[model samples]
Target chain A: MFRKYRKKSPWILHYNAGSCNGCDIEILAALAPKYDLERFGVINTGNPKQSDIFLVTGPVTFRSRERLVELYTQMPEPKVVIALGSCTCTGGVFRDMYNVEDGIDRYIPVDVYVPGCAASPELLIDGVVKALEILEEKTKAIEKPFRLFKEASSENGIINRRHSALKVGEKDEED
Target chain B: MSKKTIHIPLGSQHISLLEPVRFKFECENEKIVGVDSDVGFVHRGIERACTTKFKFDAIGYVVARVCGLCAITHSLSYTVAIEKLLGGEISKKAKYLRILLLELDRIHSHMLCLSHTCENAGFEAMFMRIMGDRELVMEIQELLTGNRIQFDYISIGGVNRDLDVQTAKKIIENLALVKAKVFSYIDEFTNNWSLSLKFKGIGALTLEDAYRFNAIGPLARACGLPIDVRNEIEYLPFDEVGFKMQTHNDGDINARNMVRLNEILNSLEMCENILRGLPEGEIFTKLKGKPKGEALMRFEAPRGELMYYVKGDGSAMLNRVRIKTPTFACIPAFSHIFMGEEYADAPAILASFDPCLSCTAK
Candidate 1:
């Protein structure tokens, strides 16, 4: 029940891993009146634990790597990560610099990548929409039952724990 | 009764902060007594890369990524420095166009800062209104430069794009609308009661402290120091466009807001002046030869004075690129202003300073 509602409204937490202010401002513009990203039921939150989407910008710098990882870990399960710039996706211009760690994917798993020197608001809105689909899929995967027994009394009226655990979900039938 | 002090920390990642900047504050009761700031989170070693990874001509684009808000000022300063070393003169039309884009950049940047300030002061509606109106300036910027943010219009010796009559008409129309909106903001900033509670007489830096701390840009100008790079730099024709310095004596958050608002009006006027009498000449002039010696260039970014020191060894790759950003220069004054203010007002006060952590760290 909560999973269905989770897709309706997903709060986002924005973290600048080491970006120029361009992408950051664009993110704000996405939320502003012109873009009105909030019309899609998205809100920018400060608390990581309450957030369902993580919008990470910039090429991850050495000093910000720890905080970036910590923020990713703090977010609840079924969360989606969107890398919001070319530098955040592949270290665009800051690649091979002394301080940057190439891209953010080196530190955290990314679900969607929005590529631009400074990602435009249109691209950001599109990225968030794609993330909502991913978030829904992850939610469904998490809620699925681990196994279903064929019969309650099998193998001399004893519960077959091994057999029941062996058939994981419904996909094992094809396998 | 004994007096005790408590320690409070804000940011690295606070909701109020747009960037990653950490500040540890020591408070006695409701009053903040001391502040310790960390601005190195956004540092990406661009200074080191400027000399090693990129050549002289490409460095202009590379430096623009240093701070998105002041990308034009950064590239313009670096290009002007290279022009000085190569000893070439750009056409007057190109100079006028450069000033046009620079002023447009300032208008949008200042609007962003003002809206952010309103958001921090707990006025979300005003934040939305200002941001909505700010799109007018952004539309004009995109019409002129082909991008909303990070316009790479500037190149060495000249600008990359030329102005057209259609775009010029649109820019004037937008500027007039932005000008009228700014006047309404001036009234609200001065007379609004809720804003006055958060901004007026709160987080003030006296004139003596501004001079002592070596504050620059609006922070210094708000306190009546009258320090502006546009007034001093000979590389651009600021005087011809009727550039006027805006200052206030109150030195508080309200004064800073007023100063930025007034500057936006002045910048709008300057843009109109440039478009009205734009000289007729080629936009781009191809210059030959590598930069042989060192040159220093300075420009008035929206925040403060941006200085670029470029040293070339007469090769394709230069020696060093040193960037002295405005926010980095005013850190001392920022810390000083927090003293004796209520801890609750910290975010609003900090917003008024318009600290660009990316610029400072880079």
Candidate 2:
């Protein structure tokens, strides 16, 4: 029931691991009246707990790695992570720098990768739109039954059932 | 009654902040007593990368990535330093075009700061309005340069793009619209009650404190400290293009806003002058020889004075590259201003200062 409403207003949490402020400003521009990302029901919230999408910019610096993971963990399940900018995806310019940790994907699993030195507002909006669809899919997947069928088991009951159910769900999803 | 102080941390990742910078504020009740800031969150070791990773010619674009807002200033300062090392003179038209982009960058950066300040003050409508109007400047910038944020406009010897009649006309039209919007903003900023409550005398730095702390840019100018790099530097012809110093005596958040607004007016005038009387010449000048010896260049970024020192040994690679960013210079002043202000006003105060951490850390 709440899953339908979840897709309508998916709040975003933006974290700059080590960006040059180019992509960050572009994110603001996307939120502003010009691009109007809010029309798609996106609100940039500071708290990770309240956010549905984690929009991260910049390659993860060594010092920021812990904070990035903490933020990712703090976010609720069925979250979509969008790596916004070339640096965050593959550490474009700042790659292989002494202080930088290359791309953020080394630490957090990224769902969508938006590439640009400072990804434009148009690209950011597209990324966010794609994130919404992913968020909805994840939401549906989470709400699905963990055990599809009740199989007769003697020893170690329900231990291997979770893995079997996950495999079945994966096969069904592929179909 | 016992007085107790609480340690409150602002960022690393706060919605108010554009970049990642953490500030640990020691507060007693509502008043802030001490402040410690960490700006290394965005540090990507660009200075070392400039010397080792990239060649001298490509460093202009590399340094531009230091801060998106002041990308042009970073490239311009570095390119000017290299040009100085090579001892080659660029055309008068290219110089004027450089100034045109620089002033345009300042206008948009200040507008972004102003809108951010409004947002911090809990005036969401004003933030949206200012942001909406700022697009006029951004539109012209995109029209002038290929990209919106990272305008790799300034290259070695000359700019990457040339100004045409259609683009110049469009820029003039946008400037006229933005100028009118800025005037209305000035009126609203001065007379608005809520803004005055948050801005007037809040987070103020006295003239003496400004000097003692060695504040630069609008923070210094707000305290009536007449230090502007554009007026001092001869690398670019800022003086010929209607440059004026804007200063205020209050040194408060409002004063800084006033100074930035007035500077926008002056910048608009300069852009108009440059477009009207642009000298006719080739935009690019092919200069020979690798950069040798050392050269130091300074330019007034939107935040403050941005200094770049380059040491080359007549090779493709540079021996050393040191960047002294303005926010790094004004750290003392920033901490000092936070000493006596209310803890609740910290975000607004920080916004008014417009501290660009990317520039600082890089």
lDDT of every model, 2 decimals? 0.92, 0.92
DockQ of 1: 0.81
Candidate 1, residue B74: CA error in Å? Answer: 0.3
| Candidate 1 structure quality by residue, lDDT tens digits, B154-223 | 9988999999999999989999999999999999999999889889999899999999999999999999
Give TM-scores for every candidate, taking all chains together and pairing residue i with residue i. 0.96, 0.96
Residue-level lDDT of model 2, residues B87-193, one tens digit each, is 99999999999999999999999999999999998999999999999999999988999889999998899998998899999999999999999999999999999
Q: Residue-wise lDDT of candidate 1 within A65-159, one digit each (tens)? A: 99999999999999999999999999999999999999998888999999987788999999999999999999988887654544343688777
Specify the CAPRI tier of model 1: high
C-alpha root-mean-square deviation, each candidate: 2.1, 2.5
Residues A70-153 of candidate 2: C-alpha lDDT, one tens digit per residue = 999999898999999999999998888899999988998999999987798999999999999899889888887564545534
Q: Which stretches of candidate 1 lie over 4 Å from their true place?
A: A148-171
